[model samples]
Target: MEDRKVIIETGWNLDNSYANLPKLFFSKQVPTPVDSPKLIILNDHLAAYLGLNVQSLQKSDGVAVLAGNQIPKGALPIAQAYAGHQFGHFTMLGDGRALLLGEQITPRGDRVDIQLKGSGRTPYSRGGDGKAALGPMLREYIISEAMYALGIPTTRSLAVVTTGESVFREAELPGAVLTRVAASHLRVGTFQYAAEWGTVEELRALADYALKRHFLDGDGTENRYLFLLQEVIKRQAALIAKWQQVGFIHGVMNTDNVTISGETIDYGPCAFMDTYDPATVFSSIDMKGRYAYGNQPYIAGWNLVRFAETLLPLIDDNKEKAAQLAESAIGEFMQLYHSNWLSGMRTKLGIFNEEAEDKILIENLLSIMHKYGADYTNTFRALTFDDFTDMALFDTESFAEWHEKWQERLGRQEESKDSYHELMKSSNPEIIPRNHRVEEALEAAEKKGDYSVMEKLLDVLSNPYAHSNEQAGYVALPEKSTCPYRTFCGT
Candidate 1:
């Protein structure tokens, strides 16, 4: 094979808009390299989408480029600065363990930020090593790819590289780096950074840039800041609704994790629930369950309010007017979230219309699921194939009664029963990244150098709605012994 290592030039012209701001607004620095970098995972499809040659990227030379041992040409690496409310408490944070390796404008005219996770520490490291553990890297790869397959907006993983080093969390774990591609990495916390530092000009500049990049239609509006806030609210509402529909809990809804681009950005300590429960929390750090399964919508609204506060200065010079405008924008979050969430719930239940009793039917089914500790994904998946004969899966006679009512509701719809069945089949996935299955795959990979299990799980997750007779075991929930397999923050 020809030499795959290619040196690209650093396109280092500052987008003066951000750099022109005061120095306190950001600390400019490049990514620090690791020793003995080796490629662990490569996402060829994503590379080709970005106009990169996949064949070259699969070679050892491309491994070095992705591992940050050698910087790619036209890449200018810098750690972004931002502040966030971590678990409901405001705290200053930045790209402590990651570096943004500049932006790539795809052939399709989409601007995607290429970032290196687990690169050596920067000013924002905060007394900790900036290394990432291999387990978390694989977990993110699995879950992020699953999210993408499910048709949700998210920051996609481009590649994963193992550092010939170990990180100490509970034990010595292998280190890895994940190349993450995002629509934009700007977060609500980015604005908070400027607002806290009293840099109004920088805040306005950041808002204007975000508006141009994500909400182009808001240009020249009298209340442009208000328009931006409303736009973000709409996107976030839809994003979180999808999370709920898929039984995915982010486990960390911190302000820093809330991207202005509205993509599911950070995949830390996130998991898909095996059984439905509103109080589900898998993050070891989330002891209080602040970002629990049921609280996601409320938490999203709370985060948007913080984003609104940062934009108050630009909303209007009058503080009172700004607060009023911001409040109006924030108020819309709940309604918009409900609209999307309810729509998704209806689809899950095979309900095609928005009826008054639809909410009651959905809530009652959930109540039964929680009461019986029934598997969330499987229960919904079974409903798609149900001919009203598998009452035992509902786990209670009471639920069986509710199923009859659901069947009656379906009878009222004008569409053919086959069409409703197909709709539910598509909306309710046959497989999800079950906690036990993911843990099982990770254990095998870490202990035996075997990735076969992970590969199998990925194959099943890719076609989540497809019925595969050979892979029936993949859709089954874990037994009682594996019921509480919680995920950890692979720090």
Candidate 2:
């Protein structure tokens, strides 16, 4: 009550470009007002990037806006409509509990989506309550920020707040909202909506808008839709490769979660692997491991096929020719993914020059890690520090053999060992959001209302490449009690 006295800044330079789309693409909605909103955290750096004054946003009015209680001036909030294949099953889905609060135009003229996750109900809420528990919302805040700090393209968390109320899940839990920033909420599922629900005119408009918004450098070819599909395929391919390089398993690669902008979205049920197992699956719903660590690239390519299918009419007038073109475009995913993955592996291994056997060498090391159950992040990070203390964990004969071959390959590069090690160190992070550590942070926040653990964890993760005695604890793999950890969708 006392906090509400602070005047809210009404200087947001917001644009409603997305709301101008065909009415079928989205539904006009406002976030349900929360009771007694309170600030949890604010990202001053990200706030400045979006041209917001941090001092103004720190006031009570800012908390009100962030909590969806007050819409900023010039803001046009709406929930987008789309569909997705959930765990290999077709389903209609949309922004059930999220609202896009207009686009913010940064000083650089870049447009970013300002969205409120856990805002409230929408037309797509289905039969469920539209709310998010505090723990999972904070989990998304932590993990998404970590991913951005790792230099991977991803939607970012700008601020988080508590509704000062409870949301019902498995049990009663505190309610919170996460302010998510993204290139745009445009997903492969958006195109699917145009294809399956809207008219061809809508589909073409979406394609043209996406080209100008995301791929403006396009050569203006006769078949611009086809070019859009190829660009999405390439982006997804490269994005997945980066995920693999960093040991990230999205846990759910549904068509809706696949962004046309190629940044990682939907942090639900996501986890970074502790051990180097290719078959690792942490999402409780992924019983068959369809979105396992090793299967991400293939799953991305599969999603791309669905995206390409949506553009068939615009790709060509002849159905058969469109199918052929789609096939060729989808076929490029594997080679592109492999090239990106191998290139990243080469950098991780400190290989400055490409070699025919580089792929094999990298795979051999991974095989050894898999056989020995070596910790993925630690293993690569140890190499950067020239610390092989855990080398004994591997099969002595096998590791020595791989090391001999790898050394021979590295010797061929003109770069000095010091420079190569620096490159490797920068490429491979010394810290990841370890499952056990994340759980501990969440438990503290939910049970005791202590956020220091999560805050300290984020501080260390911010400098993932900087190794110090202080960060050694964050780098170690958790004990077996934390193994077989399962993440929830937190719906």
Candidate 3:
């Protein structure tokens, strides 16, 4: 592919800090140029965070750079090497369709990696096309931003650009590139690569790099590898707890998809539950209920075990001692996860102080919700309503009994009714990027070439806790589809 070059713009600074690590950690690869580049959506809020000027990013030269048609100066592009347990099966996989365009230093002295998802193939292409469809790219942009707004740690989308080319998927689809900004692209799988393929020295170097970038306090620890494992455990535990509180199913909990930074990555085949079924599995690829709604915490711990294994050679020369230490750390995951989950549930129920019976109160409500097939988001939101007299809902008698107990419990607390109302509203979002709504947006874009639906959906999701009369329809549950709700990886 010939390079149609353009003069580089100003105020762009790229730092190849990760490149200082051993070359075995990553392979150099430039983004394959696209046919015609056009800007689709640029996240101005995220651009400012990276010290990028939105006005400059809208220019023709900027679009070229964003679409992976032109590589900016000082950018050391590389396709990272990693191995992940895809669906519980270990496989060697790298950046099959992405390129890390080095790290960008923000004005606040913070470091963030700017990577191109859908950038062309390299040594890790593995016989797959290194292109992305516009729908999936937009799906990521929308959902990542929504996650950010919901106060979850996540990789943010900086921009999305159309390549003006067609890619073969279920059929031919328009190609696009998503500019992904993350704290760092380092995953547990990166360490897995060093452990299995590279030398122990390489593994130690990768651990040191991760410590400096993500866990700085680990630098002073006598056993940084153990400390690093502990830190990752803490983050993953809290992260999964938050996911459970919000009714989010990652749909895929592969080791490679889990991030050491604790931020949620890889939005593929992810969705919030419409009905409160703990066994709900949305990802089309998750044939087994392995990564279902109820299995996130267990799967997170399972992924961390893989990560802990990668560090065993570094923890201590005594493999048994290392294994014992790792097991102890892994044990803490469930304890921390349950603590966080309980606290979140308490807040959702407007309980500021602890009560011995709080767990039963929360679980009883969930049990009734499950028995009735209640809409998860709406069910929580309905708790804020002053009137709960609806009789037509499933398991109404059970829910009413539970509600009476909940009110009696709340009466014991010192909070005023208004205070409780405010807390419930803040804790429970009135809306989520519902599965049907997401499909509607994608269908509008793919079949009709209309992006207004996406734009409107993003607006509604931006302030999910706030009530908007015009956007009330977004809060309603979708009519049951003839086919079951299923999400795809779009790879």
- Cα RMSD (angstroms) for every candidate in the order listed: 2.9, 2.4, 3.5
What TM-score does candidate 1 reach?
0.94
lDDT of each: 0.82, 0.89, 0.88
Q: How does residue 291 of candidate 1 score in lDDT? A: 89
- At residue 132, candidate 2 shows an lDDT of 84
Candidate order by TM-score, decreasing, is: 2, 3, 1
Candidate 1 clashing pairs, residues 3+ apart or interchain: 8-73, 9-74
lDDT of 2 at 238: 90
**lDDT by residue for model 2 (1-491), tens:** 46665564634789989988889889989999999898888888899888888888777788899999999988999999999888777788899999999999998899999999999999999977778888988899889999999988999998889999899988999999999999999999898888998899999989888998899866567688889999999898899999999999999999999999999998889999988899999999999999999999889988998999999999999999999998999999999999999999888889888878788899999999998888888888877766788555544788889888988988998999998998998899988999889999999999999999999998898878787666788876676773479999988
Clashing pairs in 3: none
Candidate 1 per-residue lDDT, tens place, 235-327, comes to: 999999999999999998899989888899888899998778999998888988998999999999999999999999899999999999899
* Number of backbone clashes in candidate 1: 2
Alpha-carbon deviation at 107 in model 1, angstroms: 1.6
* Model 3 TM: 0.96
Best candidate (score: lDDT)? 2
| lDDT by residue for model 3 (335-361), tens | 999999999999888888998889989
